[model samples]
Target: MPSTLRSSRDRPFLPKIKKSFTYHSTTNRGLTGMKSKGKMQGKALFYWSILLPALIVMLWLTLYPMITVFLTSFQNYNYISGRRSWIGLGNYKNILADQVFLTSFKNTIVYCFSTTFLEVLLGTVLALVFYGNFRGKSVFTILLILPMMLSTMVVSSVWKTLFHYDIGLLNTILSRIGLVRVGWLIDPHIALWSIVLVDVWQWTPFAFIVMQAGLLSIPQEVFEASVVDGASYQQRLLRITLPILKDQILLLCLLRTIDTFKVFAKVFALTGGGPGNATETTSLFVYREAFQYFNLGRSSAASMITLAAVVLMSIFYLRKMLNSKEA
Candidate 1:
């Protein structure tokens, strides 16, 4: 009877050991699962922590303003009277038909193209001339770059004085040469060109510097090899130099085009978009509508139009670049 009791107790002890082992195994599996899930959560939290602030700031600063401007373009909103009303496409239609806006847009196109082309051409020539260093080259270069280095406002002020119809230095010089005093800024026909002259004088240095750097970057061996192959100077220039500097020229054109398209300071300070509307650009027109007349709706529409023009120009430049790359 005592031996039977001992066997039963031993059987119950084995079952208890098996139950404890199974409980420990299940606990370990659950802990491993929690650890893996925690690691994934931590990684996701780290990335979101970095990206969230920038995303929020961009939404506030850039996206919000763009959306506001887009919506406002279609509304007749006056900041002064605190009056707002939906205008549909009326603002766009009015600006498109407005004579002042049309003139300003035309002037901007003429000024941008003329100044960019002439400045790039002149800069390329000057860069080529200075390619072979000689006496006084450094001094000459400093003098040449002085115009662009000066502040635009200061340049405009001085040029404004110089362009005075009667007592200006240019008119005085013309009188000395026994010629009629020409109206540099007064005449409607010549006012836009006068702005172009100021822009070219101030920006040609930038183009020159770029072209010079491009010329310097060309390998000397290539030129020497062309010479050894008996290529003429003009042939070498056409075949080797201009091809290499094409990208620099195009880059300068792109920058100058955009800057000139948005020209306001020179027109405001020198010509006041005037004598008539000769030197007016889209920027001045937009400024007048938004600030002077308090026509926010039309102003926004003109702004969008200007933006579209700039975008189209950028697209054109990008397409040209892509074509060059593919070639």
Candidate 2:
């Protein structure tokens, strides 16, 4: 009778001990989870601290200037006289009406398209021809890329000498061949094309390098299989190679189009938007308006127009590229 009574009393104490143990474990788990969450938050804060400086600098350099330019575009601001007046799209209206702006826009388009087409075409051809290993291939490649390494000013100086109508080497060679000495930079019709030639000569190597990299990335097994199946070079190129390189070609066009659209240095150096505005690109127009004329308002408006065009072109190419990738 005493033993049965003791057992009943022990069962009540056992339940209390079990409840205490469970409560302690749950408390520990909650504490541990909170510590882990705090650590994660600390890490996030540290990473953000590291990134903040760069973010600020980028915003200051790019975003601030862009905002300033956008605001100034709507105002008739003169840098020299410190004059400020809100004109509200008056600058854009005047620029559109200006014949000089129209001519510059047209020239920019012509130069952009012609140079991009020729460069991409020539670069692809060079890449195709030099695809395989050959004797002194490295040496030839280095030599070929030398023109691209030269400064624009240096290239302009050399070409300027060669473009001299009377004493130019090109004219001398032409005379020897019983051909007329063409005015490369003198004639208004030929001046723009001459600048295009200079641009193509210098930048074609960039496209060549890009295309070559793309070609090399393609699997050798694919080509080997094509060859084993008795596929001709043309068949392989059209059916297999071109399809694979479509993205790279589009990328090349995008890059070249953007660069060529903003052509200024060579035009400024070689012809100074002349022989009578023949090579007056939008970049030069913006520069002259901003600095030479001190018409910041008009310059900013022109810049905005150029920026819009570039954005549109970029979007078009990017869409095409994305679609190709998805396909």
Candidate 3:
């Protein structure tokens, strides 16, 4: 009878052990699945945390203002009244008809193209002249880049004094040299060119710096190889150097063109858009519209137009870069 009681107790304990083992195995499987899921979720959140802030700031600063300006361009907005009404293309039509605006546009294009072309040409020449080191090379380079180092507003102020019709340094020097003094800034016919000259003086250093960097990056062996093949200076420049530096040239052109298109402080301080309207640019026009006349809607439209021009120019530059990459 005692042996039968022991067997019954043993049987019950065996079933209990098996049940506990199965329960513990299930618990372990559940914990492993939870850990794996948590790790995947943590990795996803980490990447998002890294990218989210930049996206938010870009949207706030760039995207939001762009949308506002685009909407404002189509409205009739008065700064004084704070009134806005849809005006369709009225601002564009009005600006196109305005003679001052048209003159400003023409001046802007001429300034951008002429300055960019001449600067690049002069910069390339300067780079070539300074490519090989000599005594005082560093000093010469510093002097060359001095004009670019000065603030544009400060440079404008200095040039404004220099360009005075009679008492200016330029006229004084000309008089001393037995040449008749010429009007550098007073005459409407020559005011635009005078401004262009000042721009070139201030910005040529920038172009020189860029070109010098491009020149320095070229492999010395390539030039030696070309020379060994009996290539002339012009031939080596044309075939090897220029091709390698094409992208740099294009980039410089794009930057200078954009900057020249927005010329204002020099025009404002030096000529105030001219002895006539010769030195006015699109940026000056927009400034006058927005600040002088308080024509908010019209200025917005002009801003959009300027933005469009820049975008188009950027597309052209990007296409050139892409083509170079493919080649």
The candidate scoring highest on TM-score is: 2
**TM-score of candidate 1 to 2 decimals:** 0.81
What RMSD does each model have against the real structure?
22.1, 19.0, 21.1
Count of steric clashes across candidates, in order? 0, 0, 0
Clashes of 2: 0
Taking all chains together, each candidate's TM-score versus the true structure is: 0.81, 0.85, 0.82
TM-score for candidate 3, residues paired by index: 0.82
Candidate 2 ranges with C-alpha deviation above 4 Å: 1-35, 317-327
C-alpha-based local distance difference test score of model 2: 0.86
Ordered from best to worst lDDT, the candidate numbers read 2, 1, 3
For residues 1-327, could you state the per-residue lDDT of candidate 1 as single tens digits? 223323433343223322442345444345445668777677668778999999999999988877787788999999899899998999999989999999999999999999999999999998897775667766777787899889889999999899999889999999999999988998999988998999988999988877776676666799999999999999999999898777667878888998888889889999889878888899999899999999898899998898889889999776665554444
Clashing pairs in 2: none
**Candidate 3 collision pairs:** none
Error of 3 at 151 (Å): 0.5
Cα lDDT of model 2 by residue, 139-250, tens digit: 7778888999999999999999999899999999999999999999989999999999999999999988777766776767999999999999999999998888886787
Higher lDDT: candidate 1 or 3?
1
Better of 1 and 3 by TM-score: 3
Find the candidate with the highest lDDT and give its number. 2
Candidate 3 lDDT over residue span 34-133, tens digit each = 6687776776687789999999999999999888888888889989888889999998888789899889889999989999999999998898887766
